[model samples]
Target: MLWETPFGHYYGDNRENNGNYFANDISNFYEELIKKCNFRIGEGFYVNILKNYLSILKEDSEYLYYFKIKPLISILECEQYLKLSPNKEVRDLYLECLNECSSLYNKYMNVAR
Candidate 1:
């Protein structure tokens, strides 16, 4: 099952009823699990979740910024956001695309400013 939040979605097998954990905490737990176990399940699950999220966001004006510009700000604000990821190589490629989006946003903002 999945729980939706302002940040993202959280998932668990049978523990889906546990409403105690915050979304970030759940994400961190999975990240740590992947790091420790090199578990394909955790990584694959999160990747699928993220892809689904991006697809949904792509159709929404409010959230398209997240899949587009905000992820770059996330990296520039904290490289560890993706640099410390277990899937660092894939995340790095995502960061590159985010950087390009960031640049375009900057240019757009400058013109508007």
Candidate 2:
């Protein structure tokens, strides 16, 4: 299973550890989604997935708090994609992810570092 976040999608060995998957799955998912769907659908679906994962993380701070650095990596990757994506919607979605990832990165950097 994968937990999608504004920054990117996270895949785990199982639902119990999805947060652990972090950047790997998210990067792959973003790449594939961009290729497979139109800009509007792809962007909308990606954002929706991210929102769902954020909600889940909010419910269990302990589980996700430890993995804050992952969002930073995801965000950096998303920013790169934003520059390359031709679709406006997809680019916007990547921008959003970059913003969220930066926020999360800052929030957790003190502790994680």
Report the C-alpha lDDT of model 1 over 1-113, residue by residue, as the tens digit. 55555445545664745555565566886677546434432545645644543444344344234445565345345433444455764465445545554555655576667
Question: Which lDDT value does model 2 have at 28?
Answer: 76
Colliding residue pairs in candidate 2: 5-50, 9-26
TM, every model: 0.33, 0.37
User: Which candidate comes out best when scored by TM-score?
Assistant: 2
Looking at candidate 2, the ten consecutive residues that score lowest on lDDT are 57-66
lDDT of candidate model 2 versus the reference: 0.55
**Model 2 TM-score relative to the real fold:** 0.37
Off by over 4 Å in 2: 1-72, 75-79, 110-113
- The lDDT per prediction is 0.51, 0.55
- Models, CA RMSD each: 12.2, 14.4
